[model samples]
Target: MASWLARHGIQPTVVERASALRLGGNGVDVRGDAVTVVERMGLLPRVRELATDVRGMQFVDATGRAVARIHTQDPASPEIMRGDLVALLRAATDVDVLLGDSIRALEQDDDGVHVTFEHSPARRFDPVVGADGMHSNVRRIAFGPEERFITFKDHYFAFADTDAALGEDRWVTMFNTPGKMAGIYRSGNHAQAKAYFMFRSAPLDYDHRDVAEHKRLVSEAFAGEAGWRTRQLLDSALTDPGFYFDALGQVRMNSWSDGRVVLLGDAAWCASPASGAGAELALVGAYRLAGELAAANGDHRVVFPRYDAAHRPLVNDKQQIGPNVRLKVPKTDGGRCVRDVVARLPLMKAMSAVERRAQARNARPLPDFTRAA
Candidate 1:
């Protein structure tokens, strides 16, 4: 968002709640039009350098035998660690990003917006966009409460930094049990590893900000569940301080804009991790949002609608659960076995063909904002 805005005449002040950039996350992929957007931004080469060249995903059993392997070799797509990507993006932009502060309240009128912050003095801006992510403070203050938009996907997921050697280089190793899955991903580009845990559950009642509560929930859920290195992964999760836990959820809303304040990226339409399109959506959304605003000559009212019309289709399509979630976390043992069997069969080839076509169709044509604006 910052990068695109600065390319035009507008300079946006990025206000981050974290004291510093929290550079810890799982690998994120850029596919289709999103790859084009980064190319336009002139960061394509840098992205490729840091890309986690994961050979494939391997489903394993308790005895460490490979049930199946899906070789993820797409010349057009490359998955990069989220932290490294963000750092690169930050370096690319010259915008003033204020850290350790957030909007406390917002008031909008015919002219502009009045914003009060938790730490900084109250100020106003002509167009105040909430790129604040899924649990967006800007959305809460301007649009409505969060519960109105957030739809939980009957599951929970977490990832943490770990030195737990997955023993497999350039492969994501996953073990499935009834209603749960635990995985270890090792990148050939990086020495450090990551641990991922997911499970089927009803809406969990816990504080979003409390890491202890989230950790407790994960620990209790996989307390005795046995499978390939589940015990070791759980132990690693317990010891890691940089753990991330959240419900698998998507943000569905009627409209993304409210008066002069608008939402961008996950704050507006989070398709969740299951979609494998969060980073893609975010990059494309940011590019379009800034582009529309520039095209409209900084008119929030006109730009907001234009941005909505251009971006929502791709967002809607990606929100569907489809094969990505089911293929990874089958709810029952028999279902998991079926998945394993199918993954190893010729049927897997057909599924990949279908996915390729869908991705092509979903890759919407991004307006050349650099030229058009």
Candidate 2:
């Protein structure tokens, strides 16, 4: 997104709450139209170079026996650690990024948007875009309280990177019990493995940014699981410095803009991580939002609505495909068994192919902004 804007002579100012660009997280898949977006940004080769080379994912039983497998080769999508992608995007653009600072408040007028940062002096931009993620400060100041637009899916998940010796290489090994899941994701990079745990629960009351509280919640939820290599993963995750926890939720807004304030990525309409489209949506949406702004010659009143209209159908379709909690991290032992059995069937392969094709068909290519030159 920054590259697109810079190429068009617009210098963007990026503010991040974190002290620096985050350099760790679970891997993210870049597939279909998203691959096109990266290619257009001229980052595809670099992205691929940093991609995670997990050969497949295996569903395991309580006894740690592999019950089924889904090979990455069957449906090829470039998977890179989220951090690597963020770094790539950051390196590609010359935007002024403010780290360890965030928007405290946003006030807009007919002429521009005024923003006050928590650690920086007040400033104004002709437009203010909230690309800050699901819990967006910019969105709240511009669009009202988050509870009105966020929907919880009654589940919580946590992940952290740990020493790679905890799991095997070239595969993501997952195990399930009734209403809970525990797993280890092994990347080709032997430096680390990711510990993941998820359970069905009503949204817990806690501070969103409190790491200790987040660890406590995850520890409490997965404390007594008795099988499938849960103990070690739990121990490592609880102590890991990079542990992360959040509810499985969706952000749905009636519209994504007000005055000169607009939103992109998870801030505007998160289809949820379960959709496997969050990164794709972020990349594609950012591109289109910037393109629309340029196309409208800086008139956000004309551009923001167009951005929303152009992106909504894709968002709606992916979200309506339903909560994929069960698919990625099945709850019941019986459900896991069923999933394993189905995955081994010929129909599963066919269905996966069909689904990929459908997603590609549904995606409209982002406009070529260079053409508008």
- Provide the overall lDDT of each model, using Cα atoms, as 2-decimal numbers: 0.88, 0.82
Alpha-carbon RMSD, each predicted model: 1.3, 1.6
Task: Output candidate 1 Cα RMSD.
Answer: 1.3
lDDT tens readout by residue for model 2, 1-373: 6677777778889898889789888888887667888888889888878778888778887787788887764234688889889889888888898999989988888888789999999999999988878888888888888898889988888999766786778898888887888888898854778998888997779998898999998888887887878988888888887899998888998888888888888898887767878887888888888888778888887898888888887888778644257766667767877778877777666776787778668866667866652
Name model 1 segments beyond 4 Å from true.
Answer: none
**Model 2 score (lDDT):** 0.82
Error of 2 at 219 (Å): 0.9
Model 1: weakest 10-residue lDDT segment is: 160-169
Stretches of model 2 off by over 4 angstroms after superposition: 74-76, 321-323
Positional deviation of 222 in candidate 1, in angstroms? 0.3
Error of 2 at 125 (Å): 0.7
